[model samples]
Target: MMAADETSARLTAVLDKVRALGPTLRERALEAERAGRHSDETIADIDATGAFEIGSPAEFGGYEFSVRQQLDVVTEVAKWDGSCGWTVWAGASTNWIPAGSGARVVEEVYKPEWVGPRVAGSSHFPASRGRAKRVEGGWQLSGGPWTFGSDALWAPFTNLGCIADDGEGPYLVGAQVPLGELRFLDDWHVAGMRATGSVSCKLAADELFVPDHRCVDFRDITGGNLDNGLKGSLWQAPSLGWSFSLMAGMSIGIAQGALERFLERSAGRPIRGTTYKNQLEAPLTHLMLAEFHSKVQSATLMTRANAEETDRLGVLAAAGTPADPDYMQRFSARVLVETAYAAKWCAEAVELLQRNSGSTAIMDFEPIQRAWRDARVVTLHGALNLEALSENYGRLMAGVQPHNFAGITTLDRFAPTAPNKAV
Candidate 1:
């Protein structure tokens, strides 16, 4: 293993690359989405930078960097374009789960390099259904159209969920399928995150075959027994917390971009009527800008602190110390909900800025308008909903314990504060 200093330096280098590419990538994102084309070049640049490898296990050719580093990369990329950061962050995050019984299948999908572990599954509302039958060597997966699997264009590996029929229960099983094995449907036309190329995909259930090694019992990870190094490292410290923290970072970045555009446009052009010289001189504009800056700063600080805490926890976990499961779950849920709140905060900031900026801000191609749409869409992600998440955390805190999505149900109480409030 490399020295800690070396690892830090490597992470810094990756962040620098992401920062340098921010402007170009952001521009590319706008162009690609506007032109209705795939973001092939942007995706390639991310892959080449090894940004995705930050979350993989070192044993599997990854940097195994701290979760903070991962968030740093995602946040910086997000400053340029929300969809690019979202796509990269989502793909990287998915690899944290152990390969389980499907190790070989994962290996096959991620062969030669660990840069892109494509996960083409969608978490759209109203989940879809699948059929799984036990067969000789493995299981046969038959599924029609799965949304978001269209992202497989950039992913070498894909996951298809199906209902299992062992009579034990109906369970969702993830299988690693080569991109070549799936067909993409041209159905990902959307208002936001359009560049994600997240189209519907059709997998032939009858012809689909998964070997035992490529099939993992998703339940195994609930016990924390999978072989991915992150299970023992800081990356897995708060589990869900890291995802929430990253989401917060993305929201902050989007807000920051919107704020910058607001300031620039306000300086150049004033509202048509009764304004002193420029919009900047308008008291209302000044107040709204101040509020925007304050909230974005607050969100950015919370995101950073949350990521650092997660990193600390990961290091402790890697050292053979386990975090309190309940504490970790609450922490995770809190950060995710906080991220949504931050997105809402940013959306509110943008609304104030837009209202003051006049009719031109509503132009279809305006950056402020796009930022508004993106933030609105981001707030809808399951991870960021505050009320439900708080209830989950509250249940654990109140000792009314229940199984988290991971199936671990141990409660460890920690002080409650604002979502992503520094521990």
Candidate 2:
């Protein structure tokens, strides 16, 4: 592992670089949205910052930074451009999943010269209208119409999720395929996060052969099967907790950006209908801004605490002392619930600021409006469904384990526990 001081220095340097690019990212945000993807210059500039390597395996020229480090980088980037931050987050999220797939899989995914994220994935099986069949050497995968292929445009490989049965029963599996082998659909049209280029992806051929080395069990990915000989304290981190932290960072950053923009644009502006010559002087303006600031501060604190705890547990695991299974489960459940709340608070803050920014704030060129849209779309994510997470947390608090994985955490529940019942 890199020395702690060295890691901290590197993180500070990278953050400084990203902060320097703030104006450029903000300048290109509107253009990225209009073009349905980030500009080449924008991508290259971010790649230059080495932000994408935050979650990749350190053995493969990656940073392998802690979850908090990753969060800070992502939040800083997001404060300037939500889409760029989101793309980096998606890349970071995908790297850790396959980093433990085995040496061969890791080697194949992370090339020495890869400038962007080593991999981008569209592995949400529930949204995948496809299949996988167990073949002689590996699996013959046929899946498609996988939605939300974030950061796929610049990644060298894309991970595809499928349901496969190997005699005993069915299971969720992810296959790493070269980007060239996958076909992308131009279906990314959306109200927000348009620049993420989260288009749908499909197999270019009817079925493709993916050797066993290129595939991993979804259960293993979620459960942290680091016995693959990889040596990073981060590899032992809670998978769901780490992933949710990225989203929370992005949410808080966007809200913070919106607040900054509101303050900038509202300066010395007339109240229009009121006698106040400067809206900033209005008592209502102070109230709204204070509430927004308070909410963002609260979300930031919760997210940081979650990230720190994740890192602490990871370090313990790396030292060969694993957290108790029950405690880990409860910790993961709490992280999920807290993440949802953070996203909610951030979204509300952005909306509050946007609504008070006046009718001109809705213009496409206004950063505040974009932040509002991006924050809303983020909150609408399936995994961040506040109600469901709240219910599960409640159940856990009441001494009842979660009935389903819900993509939050997977612990020994790989196969179907009961016969499939028609919904």
Cα lDDT listed for each candidate: 0.65, 0.81
lDDT of 1 at 360: 80
Q: Runs in model 1 with CA error above 4 Å?
A: 35-37, 98-106, 109-111, 114-120, 123-126, 204-206, 229-235, 397-399, 402-423
Find the candidate with the highest lDDT and give its number.
2
Q: Candidate 1 has what TM-score?
A: 0.86
Residue 303 lDDT, candidate 1, scale 0-100: 78
Q: Over the full model, what C-alpha lDDT does candidate 2 score relative to the true structure?
A: 0.81
For 1-423, candidate 1 gives per-residue lDDT tens digits of 557899999898988888777778766766777755445667778877777677665655677676677777777766677777677677666654434324454456445563354444442222445555778998777765766653476777666655565887565555666677778777767777676677777774346877765655545533345554224364346655655677677777777777777777878575676757777777877777788888787777777888888777767676876565545656665566567678788767767777777788787667777777777777776555667666766665665653334221222223333333222
Locate the minimum summed-lDDT window of 10 residues in model 2: 414-423
Backbone clash pairs for candidate 2 read none
Question: Which residue pairs show collisions in model 1?
Answer: 101-213, 102-213, 102-214, 102-215, 120-149, 142-205, 234-314, 234-315, 241-332
User: Lowest-lDDT window of 10 residues in candidate 1?
Assistant: 406-415
